[model samples]
Structures are given as structure tokens and as C-alpha cells.
Target: MQIKVSTKYLKTSSKKMQPIVSLIKGKKVEEAINQLKFLPKKGGRFLLKSLESGVANARHNFNLPSQDLIVKEVLIGEGPMLKRWTPKALGSATPFRKRTSHLTIILETKPGIEIKKEIVKKEKVEELPIVEEVKKETKVVKEEKLKKPEEPEISKRVFDVRRVASGRHKQNLDRLRRKEKGGIIGRIFRRKAGDK
Candidate 1:
């Protein structure tokens, strides 16, 4: 399996990045990372970033091990150029082009070995015990509510329809409805209109 990663429009010249690309073009993933780690060049840092991104792509997306992967291709292409003008002698401005590089690294598995397939184990859900506990808790709560002193008939009738709703949901609905009764701006307009 082959995986490719590219970084575009890097703020470095293609010439500067090409040598680093060549240094690890055909090396194994591990060896390439080690080589780039110790290198003193700034280009090496960018190349290493792209290489590690490719390795992670292979491992997570393709289930390939880092040890079995090789740096199949390292292609450096010229990206967009930034144009500026530098003042030269005799009040004349010379055009300057700040070059950018697009670095692409391709990785593939070595031949004769199957890429390992990741096994996705479904989590074991023990629903019976949880359901049993919930039922017991509900029963206890219901008994406690029944043992409390009886409330006024009017208040019971008013709240009978909302008995099943949890308190948090009731509070949220109240907050939303209260906000809908015209916020600060609307209240200000209402005051001006004498419709308080």
C-alpha cells in the first residue's frame, strides 16, 4: 500500500529542500526519521514533518507498520512565488521573487509481507445489571415520594402534567421561554413604545 503526504507553499526555496528530500528518498521510515532528526538543516525539519505525517497516515489509515514502510518517492516541486521589489542603485527598483517549495513524500510497504489488518473489537455491554440497578433506584425514589406528606390539591393538579419531566429539562425550558420574552433590546423598544 502506498501513502502520500504533501506540504505546499512552504516558505523555503525548492533548491534548499531538494537535497533533504534526496537524502532520505529510499530509506526505511525509521532510518529516515533518525537521519532527519540529527541533521542541522532547516529543510530537514520540514521533510521530517511530512515524512512523519505519511508514516502516521499509513499506520492509522492503512494499518501498515512503520518498520515495513519505505520512502518510495520524494518529489519537490516549485510552489507559488512572492514578488517584491528591492531598491537598487540610482533610484531603480529590481524585481525580487521569493521562492516557495511544495514537498511531497510517498511511502509504500515492502514486498512479500501482508499489511497487518487492525481488529476493531466491539465493546462488551452488560445491559442487564445497569437496567436492574436503574429500576431499583426508580422504585426507591417512588416509595420516598409516596411517603411524603400530601400536597395541596391545586398545586398537584397544576404540576400533574409535568411530573414525568426531569428538573434540569424543566429549568432549561423556563430559561429559554424567559429569554424569548424580548431580550434587552426588545425590552428597551417596548419601554419606548409604552407597552411594558
Candidate 2:
């Protein structure tokens, strides 16, 4: 696997792009390209273009099919640094660096084959199994939640059962009982004797 990159983009230094390339090297070409395309950095665009160009170069130079090859390694290194000076206050100068990058991308055919693997799309991955897995998880959670039994609600009466005979109603009932008594001791203590 051989790859080449040209140093032309002039803005940010190559030091920034090298680290990012290392992280995705040896990854699937489709995945690497997808990630590079979606990234928001200025250097990402340049690196992506270089990677594509490298792949194209490999296919044409090596007589290999583009689809049969995957990016095996990607490398970016600091190139010759351009020096300049920035104006400072009071007749002073500040040193500035104009950075360049050297990018290398390597592609290889699928192991033991002269063709590249068809890039499996993320969206085409089966979804039915995932939905089923989610449903199973939710069912387990619901069962766990129902494991504890709840107590039934009981309506409590407001009456104080112990103090029923302490008020005016209790006194009236007591008077009626006394008035109805006709035994010897009861008659002696009856209200009819004018003991009211």
C-alpha cells in the first residue's frame, strides 16, 4: 500500500491534522470517509480530500479496483515551516510560523482477495432486532416495578368512638335511662321525688 499527499493548504499548521489522521488510520475506508465528511474542522476537509486522492492514486497506479481496497493507514506530518514576523508595538517584532502538512494514505485490498469489501451502510443494518431488544428491556423494567404489592385504600370514619357519651346527647340518654328505672334503689333516686 502506497499513498501520497501534496502540501498546499496554508492556514492552520499540519501539527493539528496529524493527530486526527492517526486516530482513524487502519479503519474502514467508508467509516473514515463518513467521519471526515461530517466533521466541522477546517483541516478535516483537506485531509478528506487528500485521503480520496490517495485512494484514487493507488487504484490507478497499482491496477487495483477502488471498491476492493480499504484505507489501511493514514499519516500526516509537519512539513517545512515558513517563517515570518508580526509587527508589535513600539518598533518591536513578533515571530510567526506558516505551517504545512504532508499527508499519506495507504489502501489495501481485502485480505487474500484482489477486491475491496462493499461498504456496509449504517442505515441498512438490521433494525428489527434492536427494536425487539428494546422491548425486552422495557418488559423487564415493568416486571421489576410491579414486584412490590400495594396496600388498598381504606376510608376511615371521623367519629371519636371513645367519647360518644360525654356531650349533651350522652347526658340526655343518661337522663332517659334514669327516668325509666323503677327498681327500689332506682325509685329512691328517681327525679319524681323532686330531687331535680
Candidate 3:
């Protein structure tokens, strides 16, 4: 199986990224990643990200093993350049282009190896017994519920003053609570905000 992953409009020139590709091309996925890890160039980071993405695609989407995969091709194409002017002497501006690159890495499995997809055999389910058991469980649950009456859940609006407030007031209250909790210091010190 062949898996391709492309990262477009990377903020680096194709000329800068081209040399790094030769080091990884025709190499194993793990070796390529290791080689890229020690590289000092900015292009190496970009290439590493693309290569890892390709490997992940091969493993997750195609169910191919990383040990069996090889980097088949690395295509680096020039992307759109951002034109900017730098202030020069005598009130003149020099126009410069910020070059970008589009990197595409193709990974394929090794030769003479056949990929065997796992076949999941479904067992025929007996429904009559299952239905009877479910009915009996429901009856027991209903009897238990009847013995102990459940308390009513309190509405948030009844207790939380913020919920009762509308629009700008609610937003202000939320902002105040957020500020009181931590503010900028909390935001800066917290590790991985996405985890919450």
C-alpha cells in the first residue's frame, strides 16, 4: 500500500528544503525520522513533520507497519511567495520575496510482503433469552425505584446568578469569575490548556 501526506505552504523555500529530502528518500520510516531529528536546518523540522504525518497515515489509514514502510518519494514544490518591502538607505524600499514550499512525502510497503487484513467473524446472536433477561432486569430496577423515591434535580438558573442574568451581564460575570480564578498568570502557568 502507498500512503501520501502533503503539507502545503510551509514558510520555507523549496531550495532550502530540497537537500534534506535526499537524506530520507529510499530509507525506512523510523531511520528517516531519526535522521531528521538531529538535523540543524529549519527545513528538517518541516520535513520531519511531513514524514511523520505520512507514516501516521500509512499506519492508521492503511494498517501498514512502520518497519515495513519505506520513503518512496519526497516532492518539494515552490509555493506562493509573500512580497514585502524593507526600508533601505535614502528613503528607498527594497522589495523581497518570502519563499514558501509545498512538501509531499510518499510511503510504500516493502516488496514481497502481502498485507493480510483481519477478518472479524460475527457470531449469530440468540435474541429470545436476551430479551427475557432485559425484561427481568427492568422489572427489578422499577421495583427498586418504587421503594426509594428520587429527588428532583435543581435547575442551574435557580441557584447560579450568572445563569439568570442576560447577555452582557452574564458575560461580565463569567469574565470576572475567570479573572478571579487566575487571570493572565493562570493562563501562562497552566500546562496544556486543551487537556481541560
The number of clashing residue pairs in each candidate reads 0, 3, 0
Q: Of models 1 and 2, which has the larger TM-score?
A: 1
Candidate 2 weakest ten by summed lDDT? 1-10
Per-model CA lDDT versus the true structure: 0.86, 0.70, 0.86
lDDT of 1 at 84: 99
For residues 1-196, what per-residue lDDT tens digits would candidate 1 score against the true structure? 7888989988899999877888898889999999999999999888888888988888888777799999999999999999999999999999999999898888988998786677889999776545788889999999998897977676534454445555534655766877898778787666456577
User: Compared with the true structure, what per-residue lDDT tens digits does model 2 show for residues 69-146?
Assistant: 677766566777889999999999999888886766666666776434356567755655457888899999999998
* Cα RMSD, each candidate: 14.1, 24.4, 15.0
TM-scores for the candidates: 0.59, 0.49, 0.61
Candidate 1 wrong stretches, greater than 4 Å:
118-196
Clashing pairs in 3: none
Most accurate candidate by lDDT: 3
Q: Which ten residues in a row have the lowest lDDT in candidate 1?
A: 155-164
Return the TM-score for candidate 3, rounded to 2 decimals: 0.61
| Stretches of candidate 3 exceeding 4 Å from the true structure | 119-196
